[model samples]
Target: MSASDHPAAIRLRQLSIRLGLGSAAFEAVQNVSLDIEPGQFVCLLGPSGCGKSTLLGALAGHLTPASGQALLDGERVAGPHPERGLVFQHHTLFPWKTVAQNVAFGLKMKGVDAATRQRQAEEFIDLVGLTGFARHYPGQLSGGMQQRVEIARVLINHPRVLLMDEPFGALDALTRLKMQELLLEIRERIRTTVLFVTHDIDEALLLADRVLIMSPRPGRIIEDLPVDLPRPRFAAAGSARFASLKQHCLALLRYDEPATSLPRLTPLGAPPAHQLQFAI
Candidate 1:
């Protein structure tokens, strides 16, 4: 592949993951491979049970792949590191800690001194528009505010890659839109490589440089599409191109019926629902 084909940020090669043991095992992801360019925003999108989040965890090293590899800058990923920050569906801030404290936790873990951590945390908190809430604990913040802190916390580390798993899934519609805009702003300034997971097609198109669509169970990549839409991604739900991409993704996500043979899902064992009652 040329440099344009694989710009060398994150790459997954024939990756597969299994959840359970023996006959009960389900292949959450199988023979999935993808490439993300440096400083790119890529979304892994699929239905609820399609294993998108599982792939995110594997890429972040929170879950081990049953086979294949997750690579960062062409190097194999073994486990979670300071270089990779993950934002989950839930706001993962420490309830007892203040916003600044939560944001500084990663630097502290890396043995960064108090002064440097405070400086770094302040910069990112401001970047995320949460400077005023630095002293407030998670309980004092609203859902959107809490997610902002989570974003600041991760970004403060200056991680080379960000793995986000439905970070806006819990927010109200307006808040979600605002968060998406903020994310675009952050990407513009920092050029961080992002791997985001979401079930919302519109959100994916709004934020991704490319959108990877995965199939049903034994989730494998079904489509790899670049979103060539013009950016400073405006919030026009009525835009013609946006509507077209959204419809295209919706069509891909809608399955006709349970696939009969259910491909072997190379590298992982079979799914848990194989012998039992199954629903797709």
Candidate 2:
């Protein structure tokens, strides 16, 4: 389907999520609303405890909102379904299953014939660069390889909205960068709508079409910034425009001030001394 004709991949309206019950209930997220268009890559960026994952859980139907609604394709998201696939930071692969078996598990559950499931499984295994390791168990693979298996498992089902909560957070720096590149490559091939959660400003900038920053507890979207940089962004990390946008995001998170209130940064090759210490 054309981008315009594709359905709304995700929509939230005044969504509020509370934890606990009765008087013990405390709001985790409040009055947050956003839309993710089909085939778009959107990132939820915030501090460690700012409800980024809470919002993701609500969308995944693992947690229900105390108020308002989480919708997929204009329909209320009452519970988990195959259309919304979730991948977490940790690999949840079954230890006994080989790489191919892990990827084919979903299809098997849906009663796909053995021959078709095997064919589909191999295709995604290769897609994730695990072709030769199809017979290896999850325990035998590296952390990065195991995560790739988890991704292939999810993508094999062809979910309309892929909810990833720090999917690469556990990988080493080099592996994480490779995984990010792999994700972009896969997206080009399948065009699945993605909602990725990260606290790293650089990662958000590099991957998202738009980045939404959330506030502290009772999390709300404090900043919604579009990433207009060109593709293959791996090389643009040090560009002037890239640094400027990074500084803007840092100022918002560090100073908790409006964008206008922040003074314009110097045009020197390096960011100011104060800007250097705002850790991601």
Candidate 3:
């Protein structure tokens, strides 16, 4: 089977999230409210120490809200679910397992029989253009190739909402562009709601249906700008429209900011005490 053809709507109302302990605890996100329609690609754009990941963590069920609602399809997001799949900057693949095994891990967790898991795993592996590398270990692949495996791993579960935390942040410039193209192509077939976090300006403009500009700590949505540029946006750079939106985004990110950068916060309340293992 392919990814869930059914995309889910996301709603947040007056959401406030506090992170850290008594001495250090502060509002990561305060009274934020927004709605993401089914299959819309939205980029959370902001600078360091902003609450982009914090808000995304809440929706993924990794971080709890201090108050207000985080709902998926009108149901509160209490914890992580496969339908709301999250992919991080680094590859979270198993070092010991081959690429196919890593991609199929989610299915294996759900107790699908081995044969069907491998079959579906192959389909998604090919979808991400890693067709013949199924037996290669993550270490055996380049950073971009490993990320492709990570994407295929997440896609194998057919998530309704694809939550990405700067999945290409670590790649080289050329590779990053290719991965961006790959993501747009895959989303065409999956049509899942995507809430991606990024600090890059053009990356947001290139990939999103709308870009949500956020402020520094106690993060709040300051602006919701639509990306009216046409799709297959690779050549959108020369357009007058693209230049205008890029300048606007630059200005918005500079709005109401302190001179010094804030320390970035993870989706977890504080920094993760330990590394997270795959729970899919």
Best by lDDT: 3
Tens-digit lDDT track of model 3 for 206-249? 99999998888889888788888788888987886676677667
- Once fitted onto the true fold, the runs of candidate 3 whose alpha carbons sit more than 4 angstroms away are 257-280
- lDDT of candidate 1 at residue 118, scale 0 to 100: 91
**Better by TM-score, candidate 3 or 1:** 3
- lDDT for each of the candidates? 0.82, 0.86, 0.88
lDDT of 2: 0.86
Writing each residue's lDDT as its tens digit, candidate 2 over 1-280 gives 1112242478899999999888998999999988888888999998888899999999999998989999888899999977788999998999999999999999999999999999989999889888899899999999999999999999888888889999999999999999999988888787778999999999999999999988778788877788878998989999978988898777667655454554344444555655444523
Clashes of each: 4, 0, 0
lDDT of 3: 0.88
Which stretches of model 1 miss by more than 4 angstroms? 1-8, 256-280
